[model samples]
Target: MQQTKEQYNTGTATAKQPSHEADQSKTQRLRDKKVGDLMVNKRRLVEVPYTATLAHTMNALVANKVLAVPVAAPPGQWIGAGGSMIVEADKQTGTVRKHYIGLATMLDILAHIAGTEDQLMDEGVNDGFDLDQKMSVPVSTIIGQCLEGLSLWTLNPNTSIVDCMEVFSKGIHRALVPVDSHMDNVAGVELVESASSYRMLTQMDVLKFLKEHASSGSELDGILSRTVSDLGVVTERVFAITDRTKVIDAIKCMRIALLNAVPIVRSSDADNEEDHKQLVNGFGREVIGTFSATDLRGCHFATLKTWLPMSALDYTETVFANPLLASIASNTAGPTSRELVVCQSDTPLGQVIDKVVTKQVHRVWVVDQQGLLKGLISLTDIIRVTRFAIVAEPNP
Candidate 1:
């Protein structure tokens, strides 16, 4: 008995489709969506000024509840400014209307406050933490100082989803999409700007969009249905800290590893004798909670005044002590607290996507049935998988 042409077309043709053509087909099916589709509520500028004092900057961040903000430079404030500084130009004016020099994060401020630069005060070497002086430092002074590797990417509203995925897949955590520009939908991004025209585009934004499209489009169904373990997206090599770790230690570890956040585990099977005796490995550990730079959102000018006149050692010991969870709990007046996001390795990729999108978390910790963390799946991993669609076993 021979198979009929219709039966072969329905079954064999789809299964045997060339992976290259299939990937291209998947890209084509969802390319219609544009960056502009992601909503920008109003045209008002939401960025912090380059000249704004860290005191004002901290307040702005806490008030806005944003982890980071774009540091916009006015044309005249280029005195002793480092680098060309103008990374992007307006499409309409062909000149920068409000130049965004670099980005500033809460981590940058907290790191500097914690003596990252460690300089002697003018009064005396022992007179540490000139709180007033430190708080009054301009935003421009520390914009690009603390986290040197942090980058800012610009995307036009006309950019395609595939291109955006490629950009994000390269491990870029932040991007600015210049909205209110008359878009010409070519394959490339051309950012147009007017006075006070700017908007943030996060990986979550695109991931949510992709999820919506993947739910409707049949092309991604086969890929999305696979387990994360099969997709090889779970990163086994991860950095984390224990709940017993101090707040200052957490900040220091995160800073050294160039990590924005780290998981709070109960224990770590780490050797203390290693030269690089900082980072806590959470593999097979019990994850309690997580800490990130954003958790320092509550520490601002008003809050700093209460802890005035404390030495660096005393300040750290008093505030940055053990049981990291209680020190930064939301109910208290110190930080915005922590969140725990987790999933099993065998969980479906589609379900993982749903979990991340719904929770609005940066990554999901991969755990065993007994609730021990095995690995993690970050947005970069998801984007990499989506960009390549490679199906392979998790690396050993």
Candidate 2:
């Protein structure tokens, strides 16, 4: 999935600038900041229990306006305790501990529902089941069916701002910093329990920190001079699906790739005579739009609940056929898809940051001159680069 150096060079490139001595002091100050200073406090953390239903989890996310929430194991449930659970315990105290099992993002839930519907549609012929029956299943079962071995990235409380930048530079959006836990009395026994606290550090937080703390005009110039291509956070392999592909399939692709959204392209032969035939047969691939977790909001679970009884093919076709579904799709020319912000590979780091903050978008797609998808630059990527600039080797 790696793009060649040639591919990178083809896009508009930003020129390097000479650093000025006046900016040295401001850069050093930013470098000295700790990630803990910017982290959201644990006590105010919004989380869901591991046992929560899919509907409940979705509601929680929608209510909180967050993309993901931590899934914590129920207290007293330890691995090998006649249930499949993972936890940490003190050997000497012989006490069970509660722990964060994983994170459930909006994408994860969408993927599970979409994938499960696809599977059910396939199996529905042999096993006759109504939509209500299928929809009533537990979220735990869907998670087990759709996602296994999901790993979460975490950060320590003392992590330096520079180090935090490194993680974001790798294209990760958020990291959880676990608050230290102490012994507590549970069931009349003093035992170490999973820390119920975590601080979520997001790219926005980091960016806001830099914006507020930047001391001089030259400091902003110094930070913005870095090129996006040089940051090393953009994904090498791009993941996209054709416009005619099922929305569920798009969700599955994003889930598998851990992407926030997958570009919706026209069929590969869209420009050829065969392209018309494919489009007639529902195979147009001109990068018509993008499907992201945010799109899920347009279709309420309550609506899905009502549509569950229809055959999978009928359900998918009818649901996606709606123009509302296309609202979030980012296309080059459509009125709705125009909302998708985009840039070239050679876009400057600062310009990307300005667009992100001003537009309030999570990411911007990198496209070639021909309008073909190249890579993606996210707020996390920009934050990572900014962090690096503040802490580069010659700190004053």
Candidate 3:
């Protein structure tokens, strides 16, 4: 039977399992589902052409409420001699390509805009470009000039759902599955052309699939038994900012780190009276709140325009001085600041998923017994495990 969103959310399709054996059988069925079954086919997918401007890309993402979109070669553009296809060629060169070259994400756009702000200030009026004109810069220029070194990860269509989950668990937001293609012999040279197929898999898709298939408690248990630490995918380095950090500086840190969100922490001395002079930071610091990409969405270009002229410290003071500005500051944590969704490093993966889905939040902080920050678990992280389970061979 086909699964529907309503059936999943309402748990109408999940049956009460009478025994552990029956629960295992149901989980096996879920593992058998293929990634192709859940993927959004290319024809129905939204994409941006290689030649689109940054403005056009931003409009598409905002209008669709999507975080990113696949960037494809212009229609009918052919690459390689005799129509042999190349995935991505330098945009400056008039080389035609047949496949998707990269992905343009909201984060990428934000970083580009942030980077441009520095250039505008450094060059002053001599830069010869005003605020409105800079905003109109072509996406091609930004991708080529600003993000020349980045690459997008691609996946195969036949990849098992379990394997896909592993990928998402790595904190990656999306993956592109290229259309099936074949090599053709033209005059003794191999040329490639599309079977005209592809799809995009995202965290949202994984969440939907989990909601549909793992609705029952027993079914959820089968998947959630695996601990997050067991995945061995936590980032090696954690970056955070103090609670008093300037909002603009925090944005710059995220842009540099290429992170959608960052943990907000505060440093304090340990309670041990004998070690009064010692300062405990890093994993020992307290996590006060979380600042995320969503917060930046509330900031207008006008806010950026007004704040660009000031120093970082001045920017912080100005934002704090005005209640209206404080509310819109990208790093202030705003209204929901105190309601951070957090878990321990040893917390079960299922609990994390439950909190994230039920709370409708993107990430959960991994804290220690003392409530000090340890790590993070985002939807992308949990989704990875689900994708991996679908692809992994079951034990005999």
TM-score of predicted structure 1? 0.72
Task: Name the candidate that leads on lDDT.
Answer: 1
Q: List the residue pairs that clash in candidate 1.
A: none
lDDT (Cα, tens digit) per residue for candidate 1, span 283-377: 88887677666555555454453333332223333444334424444323333234367888889889988887776567889999887889999
lDDT of 3: 0.55
Output the lDDT of residue 20, model 1. 57
Tell me how far the alpha carbon of residue 289 in candidate 3 is from the true structure, in angstroms, after superposition: 2.5
Cand. 2 TM to true fold:
0.66
Superior candidate under TM-score, 1 versus 3: 1
Score every model by TM-score.
0.72, 0.66, 0.66
What value of lDDT does candidate 2 attain over all alpha carbons?
A: 0.54
Ranking by lDDT: 1, 3, 2
Q: Lowest-scoring 10 consecutive residues by lDDT in candidate 2?
A: 276-285
